[model samples]
Target: MMLTILAIDDSRTIREMLRETLRNAGFDVHVAVDGLDGLEKLHDIAPDVIITDINMPRLDGFGVIEAVRAGTSHAALPILVLTTESAPDLKERARKSGATGWIVKPFDDAKLVSAIKRIAAH
Candidate 1:
């Protein structure tokens, strides 16, 4: 089965890059402008994995993760945070919010794809 991905980022460049990269990697990629949009699209896409940015309008990555984990159906969905923030405390916070994985921005395409594959493997 083809894996579908939901990528949420406030940056147009990041969103476009994710769309191209994930699509080229043989995954169906759906994008949202921010955490709220991502949550809204969650039901529609029912994505296998989610890649999100930490700092955004409305809701942030942590909020998204918490929201997703709040529900039984999507509590275990794999969520990978892709952000420029590399602070240790932030990483710990993300983990606490139930993120499956984290990726620093300006990420290597191969590594990003690999992380997604690893998380989605379950």
Candidate 2:
């Protein structure tokens, strides 16, 4: 089965890039403008995995991770953080908040695809 993915990012450019990359890799891809939008879409789509950015207007990636982990239905869903920030502390914070994995921005298309497949497999 083709895996479904919800990709959240505040930047329109990033979202479009993600949509193109993941769709090219044979995944059903959905894009959300920010963390708030992502959470809303989460309920409607129930994607197999999520890719989100760290900084956003309404809500951030950390908030997205916490909200997803808080919900019983999506608590175990795989969440991958994709952002420009590569700070170790931020990564640790996301890890503690239940993110499945992390990817720095300007992400390698091949690696991003592989990471999603890896995390979703578990």
Candidate 3:
């Protein structure tokens, strides 16, 4: 089965990059402008995995992770934090919020794809 993913980010460029890269990797990719938009799309797509940025308007990645974990329907979905910030404290916070993994910004396409496959497999 083809894997489905929801990628949320405030940067239009990052969204586009994720869409293209994941699509090219043979995954069905959906995108949102930010956390609020991502939550909305979450219900619609029922994605296998989610990739989200840490900083954004209207809601951030931590908020997104917490919201997803709070929702009954998608509480177990794997969430990967994608951002420029690599602070250990920030990563710990994301983990506390229920994120499955973390990737620094300027991500490697192969590694990102591998991470998604790894998390989705579980």
Report clash pairs, candidate 2.
none
Q: Tens digit of lDDT per residue, candidate 1, span 38-105?
A: 99999998999999999999999999999999988889999999999999999999999899999998
Give the whole-model CA lDDT for all candidates, comma-separated: 0.95, 0.97, 0.97
* lDDT of candidate 3 over 1-122, digit per residue (tens): 99999999999999999999999999999999999999999998999999999999999999999999998999999999999999999999999999999999899999999999999999
Model 3 residue pairs with clashes = none
In candidate 2 the C-alpha lDDT for residue 90 amounts to 96
**Model 2 scores what on Cα lDDT?**
0.97
Query: What does candidate 1 score on TM?
Result: 0.98
Candidate 3 accuracy as TM-score: 0.99
Q: Give candidate 2 regions above 4 Å deviation.
A: none
